[model samples]
Every structure is written in structure tokens, then in C-alpha cells.
Target: MSFKSRTLLFVICLFVVSNKLVATPKVKTIPIFNIQVDSLIEQQSIRNDMTQLELLVLYNDALKEKKPADSVNIFKKLAILNADLGQPEDALIYTEKYIKNTLDFSILNSEAYNVIRGSEAHKELSENYMLQIDWISFIFLYVALIGFFFTVIINFSKKANRCAKLFISGFVGVHSLFILEFVLYISNIQYRLPHTYLIAALTALLYGPFLYLYFKSVTYNFKFRTIDLLHFLPTLILIVYLFPMYSLSSNDKIEIMLEINNSYNINRYVIFISKVVSLFIYAILIGKFHYSRRKEEDSIKGKKPVNRWKKTIYAIHVIYLVSYIIYGLPVSGLMLSFPYFINYIQVSIMSVMVIYLAYMAYVQPEIFKSYSVGTSENTIPPLEKYQKSGLTNALSEELKGNLIRLFVEDKVFKENNINLEELSKRLNTTRHNTSQIINEHFNINFFELINKFRIQEAIRILKEDIHGSLNIIDIAYEVGYNNKVTFNKAFKKETSLTPSEFINMQIKKGLYK
Candidate 1:
């Protein structure tokens, strides 16, 4: 109750009240022991007040100690702590460092890091670091690589149609490069090498044109005219439009790529939509050409030339067209969503086309031969015997086609006096050029070619029930063989059987009525 004691009690009470009002700064405790992952993880969860600076110190200590596991754990903790603190840029840097050390993407999906999920830096981190190789990507890469070699083989092939093969090679080459670019995108290498960004995009314009050219060349023996070069205008324009981007430095390009919003780019949408349009238009053109040729073949009833191959190719074109449209819808922003797996459908269809082309090139190359036989003679040196001949390749090809038509369709070989001079007159060429065409194109002399056709005709007559009544001499004269002896000799040479023996075999097999 003394006044001095009352004043001392009041002062003590005031000091306690001031200490409670102005709180002490909580000290960040550092363990004297070495940093360990298990202890840090427990502390990170329990010590919610832990600062990123404390985690950074622990991460640097782990690195100095050459403990990779502890360093990666600290990096992840720093990333999450920064993300929760609303510092997405800092969080992204730490996230990338963590992923580089651990190759783990699980942290990206953790709800604890949601604050940074929509950040450009975070997106770059996910895209650049979350590298994966899907099985479909591998398959596309493998098939495209094989397509490259096959393209080379056919491009250099001397036996098939030169113009048609060139277009086929172009088609395969473009698809292979496009698929390779896709593989790189899937593998996250596109971000590393910015130059590869639009390389595949331009190739889209080429696919339809190449396919059209191939169909035209094979069916109609089409040679490129000046107007045909217009098919490349779109691709060339795209190249010019993209040139500015292509000229940018790698660092600048990557900066642009990392900042690009998920929304559609008008220029990109237009370019891609045009490609789909080009494909659609060319598909119709190719289908029209193919149908017209098919109708002609059907009317003539001559042996169909690569009819099956042409049909298969057109069918594949249609399939690819549908798949590409579906895949392009979302990618070009015509549709709402782009499921990444949708690309697999189009790429698989392209792979099938590539494989089918390889099959045709290997198994049925003869069907690809065009009417312009030996047109590649300019590239390949002429044979020694024909080096001095006056037969130009174009003229020789014309004569050869006509001569084949004469024998196979017109049955001119059934004429008893169808000598080289007579055949040359019918072909409207010099006897020497006609003779050279036979030797160079068919690898046989004029008489040998005529005799071979005659023998074939005689065999056909011998096996036919209607012609079974014709005797050997009568058949010999009918097939342009003046005598039975010459007919028997030619038949024996062609089929290892005389005319009488061929008829007997047919009779024994019940081929004749």
C-alpha cells in the first residue's frame, strides 16, 4: 500500500504491456548438423514460416557438399515455397532447377504449386522440362526415316516412270521431314532449336501438289509445264512470310515462343487453314483425274496399268485428308479443344501411306513404268550399240509404245510379212530407230520381238476351246508363222514345248472343250 511500491508495480505492468504489443521477430533456426533431405522435408511441412532464403542456403550447402539428392530436395522446397508466396517467376526458376536435377514432373501437378501454374515461366518450365517420348512418336520417326531412304531409291530408279517417281519422292520426302519435326516437337527439342519451328508447316502445302503430280504422271505420262510450277506458290509465300521469324536469333525466338498465349494466332490459323483447303482441292483434282483414267481403262479393256496401286494411293489420300482435317480443326483453332493425342491419328495414316509406297516400289516396280520408256537416257549413258543411232529418247519412246500397241492390241504381228521395215513404216520412223527402240527398250532384236508376240498368240489360240479345232499348220499361219516348223520352233523356244505338245498338255488339263 506504500506510494513507491504502487509506482514500481505500475511501471512493471506498463513494461509487460509494451513487450506484448510489439512482438519479437521470430528467428529462422539453422541446425548445426549437416542438411539432410528427410529432416528438411519434415521441417518444410511443420515449419510453415520457413523462408525461401533459408531453403536457398541449404540448397547451396548441399551442392557444395556434392550431395545431389539433398540439393534436388531443397530446390523443390524452394520452388513450392516461392509459388505459395506468390512469386511465380522465382518459383519457375527453382522448379526448372529441381526438374533438371531430378527429372521429376510430379511437382508440377502438386496443388501446392497452383499459384504458378498459369505463369508464362511456369508454362515454359513444364513444356521445356517435361520431356517424354511416346511410342507413337517413335513409330512415326522410324517410318519417316525409312521413307527417306525409300525416297532416295525411287528418285534414282531408272526403270520406273521418271516424272512420276520424282513426284513420289517429293511426297515421301516432305512427309518424312514433317514427321521428323513432329518428333522433335514431342521430344521438346523444338524449344532448344528455334530454327525448327516452322520448317514442317510449309511442307503441308507440298503434300497435295506432289500427290496430284504423281497421279497425273503415272496415269497420263504428265510432264511438268510452266503453269504446273504455280502449285508451289503457297509454300514459297509462306517461306517469305516466315522469313522474319526465321532470321531472328535463337534467344529472341525462344523468348517469343515462351510468351506465346494459348489463344490462336490469326496468321498461323490462316496459313494452316489454307493448307487444309489446298489439300482438299488437290484431292478432288487427283480423284477426278484417277476416275477419268479408270473409266478410259475400263472402256478399252486393255490390261490395267497399275490400276490397283492407283486405287490404293487414292484411298490413302482420302484417309489422310479426313484425319488431317480432324487433327487440324483444334490446332488451327476451328475447334474448341486440342487433345494432344489427336495428332497420332493423322501421323499413323501418313505412316501407312509411306509403308504402302515402299511396298509398291519394292514388289511391283514394273507397274510404274510409263509410256515414255528410257527417257532417263540423258542421265544414263546410252548403250554402245545405240550411241551412234539417230533415235532420240522421245522419238524412241513413242515408237516403242506404238510398236507394243501394234503387237499386243492391234495384233499386227499376225501379219505374215511384218518385217522391221514394215513395222518402222507403221510406226512412222526410220528402220534403224525402230530397230534401236526394240533392242534398247525391250532388250531384243526386231524379229525376236515379233516372234515372241507371235508365239504368245499361238499359245493363246491353242489353249482356247473355240480355237481347239484349228490344226497346227492353220494355227502357224494364223500367228504369222508361214510354216509349221518355224511355229513349232518358236513355241518350243518360248514355252519349252512344241505347238502339238502345248495343245496336248492343254487337252490333258481339260482346258479345251
Candidate 2:
């Protein structure tokens, strides 16, 4: 046989063998669910380090086992994980599945909501979705909270009423926790501090009582009593009730969180409602107190009194009431939808309130100062009788001369702690008569009269210090003001310029050497 013909025959034989081998069926291997694989997947999920593929596999396994609750939770976690991993489309699909399988709307406060609201996929689907919250709101809220924190800190450091400082500190503590939760929610962080919820709740419960005390401190003579500690009993009881949960392990805490989030807990709802009721009651009490005080002042003085400071505080209380209502409606089931817009409104109001508070702290430091009239009765004969008496004119002139000498020559206004009673003592007259003399002769209250002298002294120092040897703070201390903010404000109010501006003007006019 020829070599080429023999080679062709061999090739045909090889092709026939290959066809036979291809026609034969091979055994298939199936993967078994083993303890190692299950353990690894669970560890990943527990650590919140599961990949999308791993989560899907676990989710499918849960579904295969007919574990609906486990499957739903896995799906919810998958949604959040995908969102954090920047897979918004997958996150939305998983979120839809979570909603469909569980029939649960409680995910509105979860990271899933943040993902959906911020996702372009969701935006493309619904342009008119007014329920969406923007990320800017979080930024604004954070800024406002930071401002509140610093304002409280600065106020606490000031020589203000101790009760007022304590109240502001309480507010700072409660709101700081709230802001922490808000940050965690927006960032999709899964970790929580132990007893965070309990601490926040207890602090929230203290808001009304703290506010009431703050008002009392500012509006009247307030002294701390042992009985005042009773206001914290509700918080103490709640702390005790939550002590067991606080001691739970991390896994146990996660389980409890899931249960709380998936369904309404009656106890939690009751506590929330109680908080709203307490705040509302406090608001009414504050309003009543303010109204009665204003009425008394009007009746006694026979004129409209300057209550801008008090009015600002009252407005803040009203804001708190409004915010509680807006927040409580959705939380207590009184409203179907959580009014996300209320967050913006509340933050805006709080920002403005903080700014107003800062302004008051700067411009009217005396508002925070404790002032009290002496016990001397206002029975210094009627004004008509005093005018009819020949001694009235002589007494008025003598009082005026003494006041000028004390304020200008003696520089008594340089005392930061000077008050109406102290000045009356210095003038060697009754507090009522001294106050009357200042009101009638100076055409202003004791507060304004003292500030006028202090501001004048500040101007004199600023004008004389041409070598720039004195800073604004130095001038503030030298002129009976403990804080430069207050001094600058008073200087501007009296001379229409801040201390620096006034100094610059004096320099420009060649008034300084």
C-alpha cells in the first residue's frame, strides 16, 4: 500500500474513535451544602462584609429552605449592601423585592430609602417623587447641629444662670445623639453604640423639663431644689426598663433592631406619644407664664415693656412644639407618610434660632445677668402727691447729680456685676426710687441706662488708644464688659460702628496721636 493511502486510513480511524468518545455521556457532579460553606457565608454576613454574589447565594439558600423571614432580611441587607457598593440598579431591584415579599413600608427610614431616593435609576422612573429627600438636607442639619453644640458650649462658659446653662447642656446632649443617628443612617453604617437608643430617648424626655427650668431661670428668681430632680424620674425608669437590652450581645441587638423595625412595638409608640404630650404641656405652661408676666409688667409700668428677648425665647419654644408635632405625627401613626419636608423646616428654624440666640448673647449680655429689685415697697407716695410736695424737685435734682457723679466721675458703670439694687445702695436711696429716677430722668430702663454709660466709656478708650495698644477685648474688659461680643454689640448700637471700625475712623480723622 502507498504511504499517503495508509495515513488517510489511520486519520479516518482516529476520527471515528473521537466520534465514539463524544457520543458517550459522562457523570455530573453536584455541589452539596456543607457546614464549612454555610459557616463562611454566615460569618461574612455577620461582619457585613458579604459580596453581592455571596449575598445572593445566601438569599437563594434561605428561599430554598422556605425561610421567608430570613430570606426577607437577607434581601433587605442585600439591598443596602448593593447600595453602599454603588450598584444602584441592583439595589433598587432588591429593594422592590424586599418590599414585595415582606409587604413592609418600615424601610422608609432605612439606608434602602437613602439609596432609592438618591439613585438616578429611581429618578428616571419617577420625576414627580416628592417624597425624596436630598443629601443637602443632611449637610444643613449637620451644620445646624454643630452650631447648636458650639452655642451651648459658649453659653455654658459664660457667667449666665447656672440653671440656664444646665438646660442648654441638656438640649445639646439630646440633639447631639439625634445628629449622630442621622449621620449613621445617611452613611449606611451598621454599627450602633450600646444603649444609644435608650440614652437618646431619655434625653428627649428631659427636653420639656429642662426648657421649663431655663425659662424660670431667665424670667424669675430661680434656685435649684432637691425636688427638681423629680423631673428626671421618667428617664430613670426608661433606663431601668432598657437595661437588659443594653446588656445584650451584638447579634441579639441586631435581632431586636430587626423586630423593632419590621413591626410596631406598643411600648415604643407609647413612649413616643408621651414625649409629644409632655412637650405640648410644657409649651402651654411657657406661654401662660410669658403672658401673665407680660401682663403684670404692663399693669405695673403703665406702658409696653421691652420683651424682645423673652419673645425670642417664646418663639423658640413654639418652634420646639411645632417640631414635636411634625415628628410625632408619623411616628405615632397619626400621619400615613413621614413628612420628610418637616426635617428641612425644623432645621431651618433651628438655624435661625441659633443665630438669634448668638445675636442676643452678643448684643444684650444683661439679658443673661441675674437682676432683682429690692424688697422695699413701692409705697413712696403717689406721683401726684410727690409733685405737690415741695421736696420733689429738690430730690430729683439731687438724685440726678449723684447718678452723674457715680457714672461718669467714679466710673461705677465699670463694674460688670452692677445691678439696680447695687446702684440704689450706692445712691443711698430705695431701689424703687432709684429705678424711678432712671426711668423718668433718663427715659430708659436701668439696663439701657447702664449700657449707655458702658458704651460711652468703650468709645472713649477706643478714641484715645491711637498706638493700637488696646485690642477690642482689652477695651471690653476696661469698660465694664466681661465679653468682647457684648462690648462690640453695645458699641455698634450706641455709635453705629464696631470697636475696630470706630478705631479706624478715629485714625482716619487724625483724632489719635
Q: List the residue pairs that clash in candidate 1.
A: none
The list of candidate 2 runs beyond 4 A from truth reads: 1-152, 155-158, 190-195, 258-266, 297-306, 373-513
Q: Residue 269: error of model 2 in Å?
A: 1.7
lDDT on C-alpha atoms for all candidate structures = 0.74, 0.63
Q: Looking at model 1, report the run of 10 residues with the lowest lDDT sum.
A: 372-381
State each model's C-alpha RMSD to the native.
13.8, 17.0
As for candidate 2, its clashing pairs are none
Q: Please provide, for model 2 over 215-321, each residue's C-alpha lDDT reduced to its tens digit, 9 standing for 90 to 100.
A: 67755557889998987777787677666666766545444444534332336666677787777877788778767676443323212322457676677868866
Residue 85, model 1, lDDT: 66
